[model samples]
Every structure is written in C-alpha cells, then in structure tokens.
Target chain A: MSATNLNWRAIAAIYRFEMARFFRTAGQSLATPVITTSLYFVVFGAAIGGRMGEIDGVGYGAFIVPGLIMLSVLTESLNNAAFGIYFPRWTGTSYELLSAPVSPFEIVSGYVGAAATKSVILGLVILATASLFVPIQILHPLWMIGFLALTALSFCLFGFITGIWAQSWEQLQVIPMLVITPLTFLGGAFYSIDMLPGVWKTVALFNPIVYLVSGFRWAFYGNADVAVGISLAATLGFLVACLGVVWWIFRTGYRLKP
Target chain B: MRPILELDGLTKTYASGLQALKPTTLAIREGEIFALLGPNGAGKTTLIGLICGLLRPSGGVVRVAGLDIVEDYRRARSLIGLVPQELATEMFETPFAAMNFSRGLFGRPPDHALVERLLRELSLWDKRKDRIQTLSGGMKRRVMIAKALAHEPRLLFLDEPTAGVDVELRRDMWALVRRLRDTGVTVILTTHYIEEAEEMADRIGVIDKGRLILVEDKATLMRKLGSKQLTVQLQERLEAVPEALARWRLTLKDDGHALEYRFDTQAEENGIPALLRQLHELGIGLKDLATEQSSLEDIFVSLTRKAA
Candidate 1:
C-alpha cells in the first residue's frame, strides 16, 4: 500500500501550493461551473421542465441534477488537474518539484487531491444552485458523496495523464473538448438512456460516462438504468486504469524528464 | 577530504538519440567551489539536471553523501539544492511563500526564522511580501537562490546563476556564494563567462561536445595553461617581420604596426630582453611596449580549440 514512505509534509506542501493557486484565481475557476450549470438549469430545468413534467417518475428539473453535477465534476476535474500539473511544466517550475525529496505518490496525491477537492466543492455549489430551480431529495447522501469523490479522483488522474501527455496548451484542450464533452452530452446528462431506442440505448452503454452519471443519478433518485453495483464497479475499473497510466508515466519518467 | 558527490560513468542519451552526457565520471570534494565551464551545446545544464534528479540517466549510477541517487533518491535529493539556468514559474505568489513551500517540498518542517534569515541573506527580506511578478529581474534571481537554500542543503548546484541578472546581483551572488562556502556548504556552478568561474571557483571542469574534457584545480589549470603576451607598437609599419628577427618567431599584427610575442609565464628567462636587444639592433624603432597575462579565457579557447 505504501509505495515509498509517505512524506506527509511534502504532500501537504504541494497540496497547499496547488490549493493556494486555485484560490488565487478562485473567482474564475469556481465561476465556470456556477455559470454553466445556471445556464443548464435555465435551458434544461425550466424551459424543458415546463414542457415535460418527469422522466422515469422523477421531475424533469430534478432528473438532471446528478447528471449536471457529474458533467461539471468530470470536466472540472480534468481542467483543474490538467492545468495544475501542466502549468508547472509550462513554467519550468516542475524542475524544482521533481528535484525535491517528494516521491511520485506524493506528487500525484497533491495534484489529484487538489483537483478532487475543487471538484467536490464545485459539485456542491452547483447542487445548491440546482436546488433553487428543482426541489431535490437525496435517497442516499452517503453514496452520493462516495460517487462524487470517486468520480473526481478518477477523472483527475485522467487529467494528470493528459497534462503529461500534452506538449502544448492546444493539446490540453483536445480530449476534454473533443472527446469528453461529446461523450458526456450523449451519455444522458439531460435525458435517460432508457428513453432511447434499443440500438441507441445499447450504444449509450458503450460510453463510460454513462456509468458515472447513472451511478451518481442512482445516488439521488434511487433508480438507475444500470445496476448500482455495476456502475460502481465500472467507476472503480476506470479509476484503476487511470492510476495505472499515471504509474506508467512516473516509472518511465515520460514527459516529466528530459 | 571526503567526497560529497560522485558519478560513475553516468550517461544520458535522450530518446531522440542525442547523447547529452557521455559516461561522465567525476567527484566533488566537500566544501569546495567547483565551476563547470562550457559553451552553449556543452551539456552543462544536462549534467546539473541529472544530479538534481530532474532527468533520468540512461545508464550508470550517482551517489550523493553515500546515497545512491535512484535507490535512495529522496535522501540524496534532500541533501542537494538546484538553481536552474532559468526558471519559468508563477509570479503570483510571494517570495516568502515560495521559500516556505520549497523547504516543505524537501520534507522540512516550516522554519519561519530560517526562512527570514535566508531572505535576509539573499537581500530579499524587505520585499518578501511583494508578488514575484512585480519584482525586478535581479530580485527574482535572488528569490531563486533563497528558494534553493530554504532546505539548508549541503550541496547546491547553480546553473548559469547570473545569465540574465544585472551586474549588482551578479556581484552580490558571488559574495553570497563565498559566504556560503565559508559556512562549509559546497557550491557547484556552470558559466559561459570565464571570468565568473575565474573569480569564484577553486576547481574547474571544462565540458565540450558532451564530454568532460578536463577537470583541474583552478590554480593548477591556470598555472599549466597560463602564458604571457608582449605587444610592441612599432614606430612605423613593417611589411613583414625582418628575416633577421625570424629566430624570435614574432608575428607582425595591426597591419604590421605592432609586433606580438607569446611566452611561458613560469619560464626562468622569457628572452624578452634578448628580443628587445635584437629589435633595437635591427633598427626596429619601438613606439611602445607592454606585457599582459593570458586570462582564463585564452586558456579555455586553446584547450577547447576545434581540430583544424
């Protein structure tokens, strides 16, 4: 479990630095989710909810709450973690961090942990805003927290991979913009997959975002298109895959070394 | 003296197939100021990068204070600090926070007093609260030095520490380095400016084409390669050195307006008097005569001279 003796202080130092950076520009980073989710609420919650009452026995406004939160969580996790590591590389400050007594685990923990923390906070804020437009109830607040934390942690690792893989700022945007956004929108962020035709619904099953959103939605409404266990397993599976990629990156010194 | 750092055929060949370091072996003794001199493509930064664990070696081993770099990297790294040639980083943070945060990266607990002392030593105490982006270039360099010293490492690597810095900071940095050496810390720096190395180093290493061509005590290197030059401003231009004075091997320079001679500095008799006597006898009227010592720059050029 312990890769190297954990340097808690070192981890905290990096963690503190990253957190401080986010807070330094807190208005912009936090505003992203708040503004986007508000727009989603305006377009999907009110306009659509006014037209249609419910989906799968849940109010249309409440139906997309978990999905909206997950949508923000996934993208924000990617953005925060990618920028956290990528900025250091861009600025050449990564040299000092790499040279320090800090281990790979500590470095990853600091960045991924900071990204997850940002995700959770932003998720909660968006949840609160969504509550204004849609009266929401959580059947299992504990699982909701668990799924939220897990999704953040997983995507942040994925983001770290992106950060390392990217050689430029333009590359940093490719996956999130081109791949994740399309996948999230098509993964039933605003609608249920069960409402789709069989062929299309089957195709939606191929999208990994569905598992994350469905499990998160299940945490809210106690109903899900996929079994909660399967969703949890898939999320865990993705987390493991991302962790593997991060491990490979550090071991090989991929983009971290000259 | 015990060696504080040792490298055994440490090689780094980038994936792109550039051999940045070629099985270089070197040892740095404790408490000496060692300077690595090299030209632009000479791999000076690559060497520093390897020692500080910023770049992985393709082969071989490095030990710092008896700890293997790869096997015991955390311990080895904790004992060393690096000030890279140029650091590109966020200027949003204050120097104070950077110092504290950097120390913590080495697993050192916060030491407000020590941080303050380092800042004062770096002449950055008064501006500790100012955002780094607002600081001048020299002030920023000082902050880099302070950040390196925050963990109280025994060995420090400064890669082109004064590359773009102002003259004042360069002078202050040299003084600060001397002060650090006096306190028993080992300093190794790389510079393209021969004078920086000449004025600071106790020992020097010359690197060219990824090879460490030479490493010698600065005094010894200077003495071995050191020479003297004599320039004679002629009373009138000479089309060529007179055939009668060919025995002295003098070169006519400045469109034959000057005569130049090179001689060993340590020779018991440089034959200057004999040459002057011959010149006078040959009716070579001298307008002026001057002798100058060959600097480290001259020695470096001769040593790294490209094959004709």
Candidate 2:
C-alpha cells in the first residue's frame, strides 16, 4: 500500500453502499426524477408546445427535451450527492468512514462516482421518457453522452462539496432549491434565451446553466446559443472549482473531523 | 520485544482552545489487555480518536504495529480496528454485508469465511441476514464489534465498549475481548468502569484531565496502593487500645470491640503474627478475625479525585 496508491476496494465498497441505499428506495429514488421530468415534458413540451409554434426550426416540444433533461440532471445530481454525504454525517456514520484505511481521495471518488452514476441513469431515463411524447433526434450521439456525463459528473462534484459544507439538512437544500433550480429554470430549460429581449438575453448569458443547457441542447439539435467550446470550458472550470473545494474540505477536515 | 503500539508526545488541543489531551507517551505490548481507565471528559476517547485517525492530533505521533499512524497511515490504519463509542452508519445494511464492506475498506479481499466466523463469534450469525435496524440495541452493538473484527486488525481499540450494555452482554463482551487477546491481538479499551478494568485488564492506565496519571500492572497497582486491612474482634470490649499494642497502629472501632490493622500487601512484613504475639503478651484475647482488601473502584475514585 504505497502512500499515493489507489484503493479500488474501498471506493467500490463505498460506492456499493451508497448504491444499495438507492436500491432500497429504488422506486422513490428513480421515480422522482423520471416522473418530474416526464411531467415537465407533458406540461411544457406537449400542453404548452401545442399552444406555441416551433422555435429555431425545431418543434417547441422537441426543443425543450434537452433543456428538460438538463433540468432534471442538474437538480438530481446535486440532490443525490448532497444527501448521500449528508446522511452519513448526520447519522455519525462518517466516523467509520474517516477512521477506515481509506484515503480522502478514495472516499470522495466513491461518493462522487455513485452520485454521478445515479444522476446519469436518471438523465437517460428522462430522455427516454421524453422521446415518447416528442420526436427526438440527437445529431451527435457521442457528444450527447459525453456532455451528459460531464454535466452530471461536474454537478455531482458540486453536490459533494455542498454536502460537506452544509451543517444542517436545511442548508443542503438552500443551494439546490434556491440557487440551482431557479438558475436552471431561468437558463432556458423551459424556453430558449433567444425569446428574451436584448437586456434579458445578455443577462441570461451570465447564468452558468445556460452554457450547460446550450451545450447539451446543441448535442441534440446541432445548434447552441453559446459556443460549444465555451460551454465545455465553463463546465470544466466549474468542475475544477468543485474539485478544489473538495480537496480543501478533506485536507482541513472541515466539518468531517472534530 | 518491540511494542505493538507506541504514542510519542501525542497531544490534542482542539480548535476551541481546549487541550483535550496533553503530551502523552505510552507503549502497548502485543497480546496484552491494556485498560485505559478514566472518568468522563478525561481524554480517554480523545486518545483513542487520535490513534484511530478520527481526530487529528494537535501534536505528536502514533505508531501501530510498527507503522507511523500519520506517515504510514495506510498500513498503520489497516492494522488497527476501532469499536467506536457510537454505532456506525449502515443501519440498513446486514451485519454480514457491513462487515464485508468494512473489511474491504481496509483493502482486504473478500473472505466470506472470515465474515461468517466473525458474525458467529459475535453471536450475530443467526441475525446475519437481518438489517441492523431490525436488531435490538444490544444486538446492534454486537454488529459493531463484528464489523470491527472483520479486518482482523492486530491492534483493536474499544472505546467504552460496554457503556450501556446489560450485565450479561458486558460479561460476554469481556470474554470475547479476552479471546481476541489470546489470539495475539493487542486490545486497548477505555472504560470509566473500575470493575471492568479490574476484572479484564492485565495492565491498567489511569488518565485524567488530559494527563496519564498512572499506568501499572493490575496486581502491582493494587499492591502499590497497599489496601489490605485486617479487623480483629476481642472477646471483651476494651476502654481503649492498650499502649503495649501501639506499635501496630491499630484503630479501635465498634466501641473498642474491633481493632483494625492496616498493612501493605507488597511489604516484606505484614506484622500480623508479631501483632498477635504482642496482643497475647498484653493479655488481649480475640473472639474472631476478619480481613478485607480495597477494590479497584476505590483506587480509581481516589486517584481521579486526588488528581482533580
């Protein structure tokens, strides 16, 4: 066991433990994301699309699927990761994990990996459920998977940071409910930023989720409000920031150690 | 023989400016049952927390099984198991599953046989398939011990293992601890229960208010405290202890019906025979004789109280 060597066994155990918790409430965990996304597709994609016409050469219904996917992916990614780490802390089980023969890196990777895996599965499920109502076409399938994974991975990392930072259960929801959910809605999840007026559109460009939604939407329609390269960079930069926060948490043992 | 564990200047001063543990150095021999006896808030758990890596030390080093806990934590941690004061997370997990997962956390490959044996030893084999939440509090505690032993760590720390347990379970846990020590595991347990240390420990360490006040072999400590007392009953009540038997420092009690003589158990001379001869020479007769020795609990309270 070299100092820097990875312990795949520990990572797998933590991941499996988290995934087991997910399966124990499999119906609720999987249903909430897929059902919420499906409802969004039904209301915004169908009911609303029927009243509204096409946007940018794509059916209004089809245009919102990627946005809807990004919406569920972002919220669920934060949720799963945040709750995953927070429950252990709240329950005092984190001590067992911290005391074990595990490196901080292994612990983070295990948690982030499990949360990301769940979010990606939910994203794909929502996408599948969306295709039933709207005629969907992914122009670049590989980029769609790549972008989907990158967003889920990065957001899940953010959620992990939130989990460590949060001192209470209410704190866990502050970022996601107040900050992330509203940001996703305003970032063009329901409608393209193109519909906004000049000033509003420029302001929308400042929203980080706009890049995530635009890049994700481009993978489906071959067009994006923000350049794909810039979107990728923004997402990458955010991922690095979350990674930095996680490293600091583990090093200082922030709330993890007492 | 080299020590199985060593603490060199181990200290913990919390961020709140409280020194939870002062500079402490100790060594534990392999296969020895070492009991850390301390009253509440006596830095017992703090010491265990440092060695187990749950709490970072403000100063110093810990080496377990010859590996430095800080620099060689990977190897050092794997060699240590901690039965923490709190029940660990994984209430939804089965005892078997939790133990296996815990063993893997130490980087041990899956060994179903070992898991089965540990569950059986902890009396959890029948409930191995049950979710830990479904078990009673006592059973849940057994699951914690099983999980700790899953990795077969050479050094095991039990932090207040029997704190809330029933008498039967406490006895069973003690027996299991002895069995583990017999298998060559060095067991370091912290308990405020003086009887637990007196009954189970080969050596006892008394810590108080962030300091190691004393550490000695159990019997040797009892002898050093010299708590033996012999009470003699005279056939007739005496108005006072006669001057002829003053050399024995006997205290007359029960209106002089009883004369008590205290002696150090470890001393070369208890002076019991000489005292009786002197009493005979002084024409003092006894109806009966009785002797009593002070318990470890007495020593513990007195030590901690004096330290305070």
Candidate 3:
C-alpha cells in the first residue's frame, strides 16, 4: 500500500495535468456529451416512444435512458483517454512524459483517472439532460453508482490500451468508429436483449458492451435482460485483463520506449 | 577521479536489422564537459538513450555512479538527467508546472527555489506562467533543458542540445552547461556541430558507424591529429614543377600560381627552410604566404572515414 502510495504524488500531478488539459476545451469535452445525449433522446425517445410501448415495466424511452447514457460514458471515457494519450504521442510531447522519473503505473493511473473523471462528469450531465425528456426512477443509487464506476473503468482501460497501441490519427479513429460505436449499438443500448431472437440473444452476451449496458440498465429500472452480477463480473474480468495488458506493455516499454 | 558514468561494450541492434550502436567502452569523469561527435546516423542518440535508461542495449552494461543502469534503474536514473535532442514538451503546460511535474516524477520533494533558479538560468522564468505551446521554439528547447536539470542530477546527458537555435539561446545554453560543470556536474553531450564540441568540451569522443573511434582530451585530440598547412601564392604560373621543388613535396595549384605544403608541427623538424629553398631553386616567386591549422571537424571527418 505504501509503495503504491509513493506513486500518488506523481499520479496526481499527471492526473491534474491531463484533467486541466481536458478542461481547457470544456465546450467540446463536457458540453458535447450533454448535447449528444439530448439529441439521442429527441430522436429515439420522442420519435419511437409511441410505437414500442414500455420495456420490462418501464417506458421505452426510460428503458433506454440509462443504457444510452452509459454508452456515452463508456465510449467517451475510452475515446478521451485514447485521444489524450495519442495526442501526446502524435505531438511528440510523449518524450517529456517518458523522460520524467514517473513510474509506468503512475502514468497509467493518471491517464485512466482523468478519463474516468471526464466520463463520469459527462454521464452526470447526460443524466440531468435526460430528466427533461422523460421521468427516470432510480431503483438503487448505490448499485447504479457501482455500475457506472465499473463500466467507466473498464472502458477507460480499453481506451488506455488503444492509446498505447495507436501509431497514427487514422488508427485512433478506427477502433472508436469501427469497433466501439458498433459495439454500443449492438450491445442492446437502445433495446433489451430479450427483444432479440434466440441466436442473437446468445451472441449479444458475447459483446462486452452488452453486459455493461445491461448492468447499468438494471441499476436504474430494476429490470435487465441478463443477470447484473454476471455483467458486473464480466466488467471486472475485462478490467483485470486490460490492466494486465497495460502492465505488460509498460514493463516491456513496448512502443513507449525510444 | 571517479567516473560518474561508464559504458562497457554496449551494443544495440534494432528490429529493422540496423546496428545502431556497436560495442563500445568509455568513461565520463566527474565535473567535465564531454562531447560525443558523430554524423546523423552515427548512433549518438542511441548511445545517450541507453545511458539514460530510455533504450535497452542488446549487449553489455552501462553504469552510473557505479550502479548498473539496467539492474538498478531507479537509483541510477535518480542520479542522472537527460535532455533529449528533440524539443518535445507539453504544449498545454506552463514551464513552471512542467518543471515541477518533472521534479515530482523523480520522487523529489518540492523545491520551488531550485526550480526558480533553473527557470531564471534558462531564461524561462519570465515565461513561467505562459503555456508551452505559446512559447517560441528556442524557449521550448530551454524548457527541455530546465526539465532535465530539475532533479539536479550529478550526471547530465544532453543529446544535441544546440541543434537548431538562435545565437543567443546557443550562447546561453553553453554558459549554463559550463555553470553546471563548475558546480560539479558531469555533462555528456552529443552534437553534429564541431564548433560546439570544440568550444565547450573538455574532452572529445568521435563516434562513427556506431563505434567510438577516438576519445581524448580536447586539446590533446587536436594536437595529436591536427595538421598545419603552409600556402604560398606564386607571382606567376609555371607549366610544371622543377625537380628541386619536388623535394618540398609541394603541390602546385592554378598552374603554379600557388604552392601548398603540409607538415606536422609535432615532428622534430618541419623542414620549412628546406621547402622554401627548394622553391627558390625552382625560381618560384611568392606573392603571399599563410598557414592554417586543422579543426575538430576535419579530424572528425578523417577519423570516421579512416574507420570506414
């Protein structure tokens, strides 16, 4: 614990520096999430709410609210973290960070922490924005908070890995655009897995984003297509795996070493 | 005198099948400015990177303050600071914040006074609050130097510290380096500018094709390899040199309008009198005469070529 404590100063410095950088353009980093979520509600909630009725004892708009918000949180967390790290590399500012005496763990924690902070702030803004569109009931605030933390952490770790692996700007967009966005859409963010056919329901479980969205949905509405524990477990597992990969990359110096 | 840094048989082979740094051995004594002179692909950066623990060597060992850089990285790195060749600093950070952050990374307690001193010396104190991106290229380079010196390491590695900069920044950097050396810091610098090494280095090491060709005291290296040349401008052109003039081993240029002779000043006898007499015997008339001595650039090029 003390050894880890020794890294807090460095980690805090990095986290503060990165967070300050993110906040420099608060219009894009903070406001975009609120606007994006509001738009999602306008298109999906007002337009399609009349036909779908309620999902699992909740209105369709309300059913998708938590999922949509969580989706934004995860993706933005990952994207922010990935882009944050990638920017330094692209701009050649990574040399400054690399030459410093900060340990790899501190560097990792600082970046992921900033990413998580941004994602959480965005999620909160989206949550507040969604309240204007439809009534949202919270079944368990503690469970909801747990779900938010787990989902944000896992996705931020994924983003951290993406940042480390990315070599170019195009490469940065490929994962978020081609892989992450599609995963969110197919992860049952807008629809419950119960609405899926037999084979598709089973396949949806394999998408990690599905578990995250389902778990967050369960926290809000007390209804889910899958068990929250299993989703939580999956999120935890993914977080661990991501941490392992990040540690390995740092230890080997991978692409970070000059 | 104890060596603050030593490289023994260090070699690096990149994945692209390029041998970046060959096996080499050298020592950097404490409180001296040692310059590593090489061309673009001469592995100067690679060598510095290995010493700084930024790059892993494929073979051999590097010791800092008698600590193996690989085995005791934390301790070794704590005692060393590296100013990389590239001017890479966080554009979003202010110089003060960046330097403070760098000091934090080294696990050192906050030393505002020290950082302030470094900032002032680097001429960045006035711009301490300004964003790095807003600073000019030369200012950013100075920030790099400040960041490297933040920890106050005993051994400092400056890779091409004066690559691209205005004369003012260059002069300031050199002055700061000398000040650091005076304060008992050992500086190991790599530069393509021969004059930078010639003007600043107490000792010079020439590396070529990833191998260290020679390492000697600056004055000694020059005196040992330096050559002097005497040039005499003839009053008139001659079709060919006479047999007596041949004894001077002089080469007539511009159809005998000039005669160039080379001699070693270190030799027991330079034979300048004999050469002048031979020119007289050949009826060669001189309009003007002058002598020039070899510089570090000439010695570097010749050493590298000879090794190749």
Candidate 4:
C-alpha cells in the first residue's frame, strides 16, 4: 500500500479508538459540562447578578454568560483530550496503540479531533442553556464560530501536552483545574478587566485565556473589554505556541515511549 | 534462510539513567518460533518494544522483514504485530469492533470473515459482542491476541503471552501459536516460563541484565549444554558413598537410600557405567534405577547464574 494510504488508516484507527473511549463514558464527558455550566450560570449569573446590576451596559447575568461558556469549552476540551490520551498510559494499554503502525501526526490529530468535538458540543450546549436565563445575542455569527473553533483547537492541543506530561491522575487535574481554571476566572470571566486596578488590568492582558474569553465575548456582544484584533492575535499566538509544543513532544516520543 | 528480523547493536537507556537494553545484535529467521527467555528487568520487553517501534533505540538499528525500524518505521511497523503484556481495550468495545478498528489502524480494508475467523480461532466468537471488561482474565488475553492478529501481520511478538494465565488458556494459547507458525507467521516470544519455551520455541534466546547472552535452536541449545542424571535407588541404606567412588563426585540422597550422578549427555563416555561398576565393586546393591533428562529451566538458570 502507498504511504499516504497507510497513514490515513492509522489516523482513522487512533481517532476511532479515542472517540470510543470518550463516548464510553458519555455521562461524565457530555453531561458533566452541561451540568457544570448550568451551575455557573445559576451561581455566578443569577445569584451573583442579584446585586451587581450591570457591567458595561450589559446586565451582569448576560455579561458573564459568554465568559462562562468559553470557560467550560476551553477547560473541558483541554481536559478531555489530555485525559483521553493519558488514560491509555495509566491502564497500560498505550503499549498496544503505540506498537501499531500509526504515526505521531495521526495519533495527535485523532485525539485532538475527538477532544475538539467534545469541547465544541459542550460550548454550544452552554450557549443554548444560557439563553434560557438571559438571551445570548451573537453580534457576528461568523466570528463566534471562529472563536469557538480556535478556542477548542488551542485548548485541545494544550490538553494533549498535559496528558503526555502527566504521570498520574492528580498531575492530569493540576494544570486544567489549578492553573487554567484559575487563570480563566481571574482573567475577567465574570466582571470586566476595566473594573480592576490599572496595574492589574495590564497584567490580565498577559493571561492567554483572557484573550480567548475576550475574543469569544466580542463575538457575542461586539463590545469587548479589550480590542478584538488584539484578542484574536493573542489567541492565534497561543494556538501556534501550543501546536509547537505538541509537535515537539510527538517528535521526541516523550512519555509515549515504552 | 534469510533473516526475518535483525537487530544491530540495539540499546535503550531511559532518561532516569536506567539502561533498559544494552547494545546487542541478534537475528531471527522467518517461520521460526524464537523464545526470548529472561527474568524480569532483563530487557526482553525493551528489545520487543524497540523492534516493534514502540520505543526508540538509544544506540542501535533494528530491521523488521529487512525494513529499518526507525528509518523505515511505517513499513517496518506494518509488517509486525505485538501482543503486549498488558490487556488494553475499551470497556465498552466488543471484540468485533476492537479487531476491525485495529486492522483499520494498519490501513487494511474491512474483512469480516478474517475478523470472524480470528475470533473463533481464539474462542472469542460467542463473546465477540460482550464488552471486553466483562470477559474473564483468560478471555481478555485471547482478545488481546485476536486484536494483534487482526491485521494479519507476518511477524508477531508475544511478550509474556502466557503470564498470569490459567492452565487451560496457556495450553490453548501454545496450541494457537503453533497453528500460527504452521501458517508461516514468525513468532518471537518473551517468556518467564521455561517449560513454555521448551514446549513451543523452535529457537531459544536468553537475555539478562540488558544483554543477549545466547541464541540457538532449542534442540541445539539443550544438546550442547544439556545433561542427564543417573539416580540409583539402593536396596540397602549406606552411611556414605564408597571411597573408591570418590572420583565420580556422586551425591548421597534420602539418608543414602539413593545415589545421584550428573553427567554431560554430549560427552563421548557418559561415565555412568563406570560409576555403576564401581558401586557394584563396593557392594552397593541397587533396588531400581531411573534416568532424568535436564530441562530448559535447568539450562536457563545455569546460563543466567554463570553470567551473573
């Protein structure tokens, strides 16, 4: 068989394998994001919105809605891809997959694709679910789709790296939960960065997730706390950096080496 | 016969400063069952991993079916199948899906009859619809083998294929391995069970401390180094071996009820007759005598012990 034909087959297998694994536990994979996003809306939007009337002409409930949706999408996408790849390692079944004729490119694409799918689906669910509480208005439908695609792709790649680096379950949760989640929340997921002190506002711009949330929020409201151009540039920059790391890991075989 | 697989100074050293495989060279011919017998931590798995393209060799080259494992990895990997020690499969997946998916991983088209035949051969046809997690340990192992064989690889690596398995499954597995060999599939197995190698291996290779100690045909290995023991059950108890029989280095066992003599089978004169004659001269009467042949386990222990 041709080399291209061989690679395509390996890629399909890895993708199918990863997809089957995630879907095997669809309850935790699919439902958990919806439920968690719902709680975020109720607690951060409804409960917290009871006092804070408005932030930048938008109601507090609606203002945090885009940020929360993006937060869920980014974290879950990254988590699923990372955890999905890492599961084979923990279970010792990774040996079987690695021993197969699949190339690293195929391996990465399969896992990232499955993870991006999960992230996108969950992001849409959160968007739909949030509309029930406060109508979600998409200012630029095209930009919104772009934001969703980039956010999911970037985080999914990041998550794949996390999976390779992580040796244990605790290690797996550390980056997404402790590092990424905190950065997202403090990056102005709820209140605008404009409300923060001048010095803190500048520091928040350095947070990659801040640009992701801002870019995605701009897609929804057209009025973002930061420049859309800067947000898009930062998001793209983060994606490139992440892609570089993943490509390097695959080249070296990293932890996937037996 | 041309070598089906060849390793040229292959080595693997983990980043942790542990040398998993020492630089070693070896060759395995086509249509032969080569058993790699090694104790745990002897680098058997590392060699298998490198040959199958799971781990990068630290400082050597490996060629599978004449294809370089590293430089021509895609072709090399396509020609081989590895039945790993671990039982890795999705809890929700059926045997059919897992095997088909694995075959597809190698870019093979869907062949339901091949999949079904492999399943039935492994005695997994009835359980093909069952989730892998639900199967018994022995059955799960079979599924692993079936999955490995799904792509119809010319070479198969069974790393401790029978480890931690039941007797019935072990026997069935060996039988299946022989059948696979009959169909021209080269089998390279790493086993802790010396008897398994003795029973199934056409050629035996021993690895220890990340080094390849020896590689030879099973019969040749045994015949060259194998020994025979003469055990005599005496009719009367003797306090000690006769002084005249001291040259024999004989052993007195069970309070001198029996005498044991070890001799190389390959020796021109086995010296058993001389020992027996000496015993008769010493008035050491024998009730009954039996001979036992040395096993592959004996040869393996002696080889590893000598290297240590």
TM per candidate comes to 0.95, 0.96, 0.94, 0.93
Clashing pairs in 2: none
What is the C-alpha lDDT profile of model 4 across B1-308, one tens digit per residue? 66899889999998888998888999899999999999999999888988887787789888888888777877788889988887777656898998988898877888999999999999999999998889998898898899899989999999999999989889999999999999999999999999999999999999999999999999999999999999999999988887898888989998989989999989999998888888788788899999998999999999999999
Candidates, ranked, lDDT: 1, 2, 4, 3
> Per-residue CA lDDT of candidate 2, range A145-170, in tens?
98999999999999998998899999
Runs of candidate 2 exceeding 4 Å displacement: A1-4, B234-257, B277-285
Docking class of 4: medium
True contacts kept of 3: 0.42
Tell me each candidate's i-RMS in Å: 1.1, 1.2, 2.1, 1.8
Q: Model 3, range B3-101, lDDT digits (tens) per residue?
A: 898889999998788999989999889899999998888999999877776776889999888998877766788888888888788888899998988
RMSD of each: 2.0, 2.0, 2.3, 2.5
Residue B49, model 3, lDDT: 79
**Per-residue error at A239 for model 4, in Å?**
0.8
Model 1 misplacement above 4 A: A1-4, B232-244, B253-258, B266-268, B276-289, B306-308
Error of 1 at B167 (Å): 1.9
Model 2: per-residue Cα lDDT over B156-260, one tens digit each = 999999988999999999999999998999999998788899999999999999999999999998978847899999989999989888888889999889999
TM-score of 2: 0.96
- CA lDDT, candidate 4, residue A115: 88
Colliding residue pairs in candidate 3: none
Following a full C-alpha superposition, what root-mean-square deviation does model 4 have from the true structure?
Answer: 2.5
The alpha-carbon deviation from the true structure for residue A52 of candidate 3, after best TM-score superposition, in angstroms, is: 3.4
